[model samples]
Target: MTGARTADPPYLASLRAGYDRAFEATVVATPPEGVVLSQSLFYPVGGGQEADHGTLVTPDGIRVAVVDVRRMSGAVVHRLEKGGLVRFRIGMTVRGEIDWARRYTHMRLHTAQHLLSALAFDRYGLRTSEAAMSGHGGYLDLEGMLDGEEPIRRLEEEANSRYFTQPVQVESAMVSRAEFEAMPGRSSAKSLPQGISSVRLVLIEGIDRCPCGGTHVLSTGEVGRVRVFRDPKGKVASTRLSFELLEEREGPSSPP
Candidate 1:
């Protein structure tokens, strides 16, 4: 926690600036689990989103593969592969670069999840209980029952319509916890830790506004086409809806 500060890390701080794939930071602490940087662009695993995989290059030209990232005691820890610990020392400058292909896919799938979740909540009064994102697709577990394929079909149609036709813009902002709680239709506020005084809200234009820490695309159009389906393994009390982005003629794209 040598360089730890109360302000948001580089990954969260740059989210509104369209985020960064690479960054230069100084090694501030070397904990038993991993190394902490003065600033970092690697996203740690949280909010149902996976951690970012990347590489950290030392000033002396040794490349250390970052296998995992996690937030520990208010610090972002970049866990490196074996033998990487000896290559870095406190106060040394290093360059970090995230795996863009994997990160871009995450951005697309995460935004698509938001659209689908918003639609489900508005159309059927369902609340999203859990979500998991992957390179190929993602899924959202709703708190209520969603019977049959008709609802899934309709949701899929609505999501694609918004993506291809209307193309809603996505934006994010940091707000006081009190301000966020006062806002209408706020969800999952109580689940946040009591020490967090600020909340980050992701707005999908007029469609959705909820508390989220995950990365997302700048617009719905970047999600391409989506395919929504019901997961049979969902709990009896809740419905799990999964989605995959269809292949586009333009192929995979990155967020700006």
Candidate 2:
């Protein structure tokens, strides 16, 4: 039952820039499902990405666990664990911090998807029909077939070689809907709803550009080496590339 507010939320702020994992904001309302913060960095579930889990600390030092986040009716609702709702109230100030390990893994996996999708489209004229990411790994379903394991091996090798040698930088920006629609290899933007005049495009340097609202690493190097293979559950017409970050000496570890 939170009323409308004008302040830009933290997730939107980080949408085109570096992510701020922790933030402080006022509680605007406490609906039955969760607390509505005046501003929050927690990413709600959307764009085939998972919601961010975190903790919210009240001004009086009581720590409440934020078990889930969702965007409801234009507001970001931070759902608390059972019995944690009583610690918050309208107008109360709180500090929120996301689970960095999970968020970072998501960032890496998401960027890896973009990389692999770009490679597939560029090398084989295949378009990504779907993509989903998790702390464990991610997958992209392409509109074409890989024919055999050799193509998969080549795709994986090219992705890893680019990561180690070229290290493409990833960045996001807002473009006019017209510009987004005009860009080549932007089949993904076709799914965007109407009335959106502007679109956020995630660009992997010279590699690819696509409309996306998910968090990503700053560079392909941060994604480290990836293992790209055929998904056993893929449909008959489409080829699914299942991928995960291989553990590297300097890269983030896979979630347990």
Candidate 3:
């Protein structure tokens, strides 16, 4: 893969990828241990989602711990733990596995973000100005001032109402600018990089649909419960909403 930029989008099949994570790929570049691959299972850090962490086991049984993944100059780069360079070499075949448990949590929270952001835009005319996600929880900053009393609670009710009424079946599609602009739930493109002509849209059915590159849950039901909280010392000029995802269980709980 030397000097060749990946022509095909680097990922698994959209339909099957919703549930599958493991795949085989060849090392096209090395030294830093993340350069190019015949195909990549790792989601590079972008669009408010963290990169995947896992182990790359060679055909000969050597293991390289993947600590971070990124993309530069159109090449996907996987930064490895110390000593990884000593164990890996170019032209080696390896099995690539993503940290699915952590990735899944981000997926759940990410999908929940789409629904919540859409609700803010649809109901309150607020656009998502910025967002971030991690394994445990995350937050979205809206592009408008929230003036009503108990706004966080109200947002939670609106989001959860739509979330619970629907199954969490997720669908992703690639489309041009015009096609994406036609979607109903489109919100602030803050989380997206500028100058992107093609759009990757992940839809939570009717609840929300937006341009995004982050991994999301297979469906909204997987999101369980969504709680919206406020930052202390009252509000900022633009509303910032912090949220957490809780799994379905007796009484109350948060995902571990």
Task: Tell me how many clashing residue pairs each candidate has.
Answer: 0, 0, 4
Per residue, candidate 2 scores C-alpha lDDT tens digits across 1-256 of 7463425454443443335667789988888989988877787888878998989999989988988998887678989999999999888989998887777778788888888988999999999989998766889999877898999999999999976235777777888898877777846556888899998778888888878878887778877778888987988889999998786323333321
- Give the lowest summed-lDDT range of ten residues in model 2: 247-256
Q: Provide TM-scores for the models.
A: 0.91, 0.91, 0.85
* Weakest lDDT window of 10 consecutive positions for candidate 1: 247-256
The lDDT of model 1 is 0.80
Predicted candidate 1 versus true structure: per-residue lDDT over 1-256, tens digit per residue: 6546323664454454434678788888888888888877777888878888999999988889999999887788989999898888988999998887677777777888888889999899998888898767889999999888998899899888866345688888889998987887627677667888998888888888878888887778878888889998888899999888786423234434
CA shift of 184, model 3, Å: 5.1
Report the backbone clash tally of model 1. Answer: 0
- Give the best candidate by TM-score: 2
Q: Which parts of model 1 are misplaced by more than 4 Å? A: 1-7, 14-18, 164-166, 186-188, 248-255
lDDT of 3 at 168: 58
Per-residue lDDT over 1-256 for candidate 3, one digit per residue giving the tens place of the 0 to 100 score:
3563433444433734644466677767763445466667778887888888877888888777789987766667778777676666677777877767776777777778788888888788887877888866788888778876577788898777767445756788888776666655545444446787887777777656777777776667777777788655334688888888766322112222
lDDT of 3: 0.70
Candidate 1 residue pairs in backbone clash: none
Candidate 3 minimal-lDDT segment of 10 residues: 247-256
Candidate 2 TM-score to native: 0.91
Supply candidate 3's per-residue lDDT for 209. 71
Clashing residue pairs for model 3 = 34-78, 168-219, 168-220, 169-219
